[model samples]
Target: MELGYSDSVRENVEILDVVSASEEVGILDDVINQGESEVVHLKVGMKFDTVDEIYELYRKYAQQKGFPIKKRSSKKDNGVLRYICFACCREGKHKTDSETPLQPEPTSKFGCKAKLSARLDLDEKWRISVLVLDHNHETSPSKSRFWRCNKKISNHVKKKLLLNDKAGIRMHKHYYTLVVEAGGYENVTFEEKDCRNLVEKERHLKLGEGDAMAIQSYFSKMQKHNTGFFFNIDLDKEGRLKNIFWADGRCREAYKEFGEVITFDTTYLTNKYDMPFAPFVGVNHHGQSTLFGC
Candidate 1:
């Protein structure tokens, strides 16, 4: 059978909207609404979601158990593909970097290592399977935020960064605002350089290298359909589009009548590609604003 969307899981999106070929395993007489109600198959602690969600659940469980927890280890660097396993634990003292040659001896550390591991099962919607939930230390209330996960960035801060990114805010400005919103730069898990890289990467990803065949494909479709459309494009020496003008048959006819005394406005909204957007306007016989070109 022919496949659907190329990628399996969605990015910065909901998996509920993504329907795969596997979802339509059997063709029936009547179509079923996939979003009506999902088949929630699970045991007591088992759940269906991403590994990050599982980690959050684990963290919440540890917190409810009156113990501060930290991620012991993870199987992968990114995504819940194939297989991913992570261990959450009741943390103790910080360890010294004894592997370094310049480090001193007798590392000052604590004595708590209660841990639990959650593994992703590939067969069942990447459901989290609790591998182990063991604790050797006595359970107690959290008094301080010292031995917590230092690398854990809060979801609120992440959402703020993503929202600002969508709002077209630059990185340095965003970093300043984010630091203040996060209480201080020291409170944030990642560095300023990380935010900068993320913003730069987002810029590249959002406005990727323009599709090379887009213009050609458009022109091909226009020629194939034999539409009476006029178009002009001026490119710089580097094959970059500097100026483009297009007018459909109807627009051209309107321009032919209200052609004289056309006022061109070069001032308008700004674009990232540094291309000028000028609109040609004119007043018709009825004294109403009429468009000539752009």
Candidate 2:
């Protein structure tokens, strides 16, 4: 069943078809001729004057299996008539000089084009190798959005912020003491009693009273000028303002009136210990103030 070039042959010749009686005799003759100088090798093997007798013996063996004998001219040496039998069940003429060698058709699978080759002589194994080539098919577009605000803010905050997820905006409760120097707020200091009262109420609801007061004061000041407020919320984290019913209702009204609002909703808090605080501030028509509440 094994097929390959004989070790005695110098050239890299591959035997493609099934081994026939004539082929075996031709191979044996080549082996003996190459090793004729060695006496020990010649003594162990029988010498054949003609390949015909060897082919006849092979014919008898093949006849038992109902195989037909064939005649072919040797490509190796011109004018050398060689007797062969088609042992392979499949029907195909032998490849000629003008015909290309048998090779697998190119195919695209497993992310690349693969080439296949069969070697009956070399262990009778099918070898497959991949080659990277440009494909004509179009590639799929990326799923991520180009102007992803959440991704930008998430990178700025060093945290993951998924869109449409419930989130809150508030002052830094634990680091409220640091806001005195942050300079973002208008008034930094309040009475000790006022701070204590606000803290008590905020602690009862687990929210920041100072932040709520800042928002309420801002909106009340804007209301003096009869302005509308429009804003957005980070719906990723749980926050007091995010859950506030009145502030959300007012924002919806403002959106309807102004057609659009310039609101920058971000969660990067000035105080590291505090949650993100999104403050919405904009100017509306008629020189009125548009504000975000809570």
- Candidate of highest lDDT: 1
Candidate 2 regions with alpha-carbon error over 4 angstroms: 1-250, 265-273, 292-294
Task: Write model 2 residue lDDT over 1-294, tens digit each, in one string.
Answer: 866656633221211111221232332222111221222211112233344543343333323323323332222225533222222111233333544447644332222221111111233222212111222233221211111110111121111111101133122321232122223222222222333444344434334536656656666665566554433322224445543322445665665677366665666654523454555655667767775443
Candidate 2 whole-model C-alpha lDDT, 0 to 1: 0.33
- Candidate 2 lDDT at 252 equals 52
> Looking at model 1, which ten-residue stretch has the lowest summed lDDT?
27-36
lDDT per residue (tens digit) for residues 1-294 in model 1: 863544533221222212112232321211221221222222334655666766555555554454566556666536545445444343456656678767656632345544545555545455554455555556653421233532343444455556666656555665654444446644444666766655554444132245434755686576457576666766656565556786666667778898878888776645554345788888888999877667
Clashes of each: 0, 12
Clashing pairs in model 1, backbone N/Cα/C closer than 3 A: none
True-vs-predicted CA distance for residue 277, candidate 1, Å? 0.7
TM-score of candidate 1 on Cα atoms, chains taken together: 0.29
Give the C-alpha miss distance for residue 14 in model 2, angstroms: 89
Model 2, position 147: C-alpha lDDT score: 12
**What would the TM-scores of all predictions be?**
0.29, 0.17
